[model samples]
Target: MNVDELILVSIDDHVVEPADMFKNHLPANLADQAPHVETDASGVDRWIYQGRVTGVSGLNAVVTWPPEEWAKDPAGFAEMRPAVYDIHDRVRDMDRNGILASMCFPTFAGFSAGHLNHFKDPLTVIMIQAYNDWHIDEWAGTYPGRFIPLALLPTWDPQLMVAEIRRVAAKGCRAVTMPELPHLEGLPSYHDITYWGPVFAALSETGLVMCLHIGTGFGALKLAPDAPIDNLIILA
Candidate 1:
């Protein structure tokens, strides 16, 4: 088979979320607390939530950069191609690559939303649902079958996670991203039946897949912070 004839479906692509994701989704009361991007004096953009920076790296969206330019991540969204955040452009990019469909994980939201655990309760759940709405209702919904809907769960609370699983499944989400090692994130481990039982049950009942992505529960390999990222990719 020729390379040009081989169609592809990427299950692990990612989206550099748009800046106004929470703008129309969140309620007026939570607007002030919703996550937003702020650019520092150096013009480096970071996701800030409730007065704290989420500390997400830009490497997640560096694919659009030239090979030599990928050594370091783009400092801000301004440095990325519109396809990194725009669904319309993303579909076109997929077409160019012969990708029939793609499932995009969240970016600043953390692979499994562990970064959101620092925030308070209902607010965290709210933010997650809002993100899901943008991802499911707008992002994937806009292009129909061209994309797979992947939702983020508030894993800090198992009950909340179950509710979110059901909610997003109703919204047409086929899967939810979860931390590979919940215990490392200060949550109960998979062995803790009491903690994960209901959550697992909810996922099974709703028929939504639970996607445990690497590096979500902390880095998969214990490499130094300054180590070359290529090492992790090659080794992983």
Candidate 2:
């Protein structure tokens, strides 16, 4: 056999979160305040709600889109035929490409979290927990050994961070992604956050890697008023 026949593995693939997540998980009172937007024939619901916070009002509105919209659809838009968002399609692609295993990160859910700064801390934490559970139950459990899940910790609270780490680990996650920059004001960088030492140590002991993925770092930057797309490309 050729050595080149060895299987490959991708450590950082992403899956689009299903759109109904917020509709299903948000408290009934809050969910009522959000309006559902139309999705494709998938019957998936997208919702939006304005943020009450200042300085970020434009960025404060949250939008949810169906995961299928992120997938390849031959009958749909020509530009949307990549099929990366569907787990089954992704697995087939991986098999054809000689990939034996893959780890999936959240796409839409994490993107939503970026705009949810105005939400109360408890609600934010609840959202993270719900997303983590949904990923495990709906994604990883579906494929067993073929798909490894990555958890997202509540970076705003160190104690909860440690608890969530253990909880998700027990649910079969092998890695976790935390904000590369502090998510909360007054919190230090990852390297300097003393309260997070135990969390990091626990991850080390468990052989789980703490991933600092893009769009997850903390810092200020300057960008042209009309150059958001170019800025994103350059940053990516």
Candidate 3:
């Protein structure tokens, strides 16, 4: 077998959160406050969350187009693979690629779902919890062993993050997506032993791995302002 063709485990794939997630999971009282989609003046659909907006970065939704298209400009929802947004279709694609297991990070929710912290308390907590519930019950459940389940902690508060870690661990989640370099964005850095004490405590007990995805690390791509996308991706 060609070893490259036999790639089986993809630990850093991502999923586009379904638009109706909040509608399906949030109670009527809080559903209206949940992040919803809207096409902007430019006609691109973006997630509007508590005054912060995020659009699909071409990098994350990269399978359906030529590299030039996906790696250069931002791709709207229409440009992504149906599999990138649908669990059933995703499994079919995974099977086709011989991917026995995959772990998906959040798209609109940001790498660790850390971007959601920009919103107020309680609501943000509810939103993150809802995302995890939907991820496990809906997404991963669709393929069971074919998809490894990972959760995102509220990185702003270590104690609360620890609690979430334990909670998700109890629910069978074995990994979490986190910021690669936390201090760069004002969150506690990985080197801060005291800050991550509770987090390590919970994970040490549950044996979960802390997964760090790019884009949540120290700074954005260090490319010249006028550099071509190809050059940046090449450097990356």
The best candidate in terms of TM-score: 1
lDDT of 1 by residue, 163-226 (tens): 8888888888999998888877877889999989999999999999888877653444566777
Best by lDDT: 1
Q: How accurate is candidate 3 locally (lDDT)?
A: 0.79
Off by over 4 Å in 2: 1-6, 21-79, 111-118, 183-186, 217-236
Q: Rate the local accuracy (lDDT) of all candidates.
A: 0.82, 0.58, 0.79
Order the candidate numbers by TM-score, best to worst: 1, 3, 2
For every model shown, what is its TM-score relative to the native structure? Answer: 0.93, 0.67, 0.91
Show where candidate 1 strays beyond 4 Å. Answer: 55-57, 71-74, 217-220, 224-226
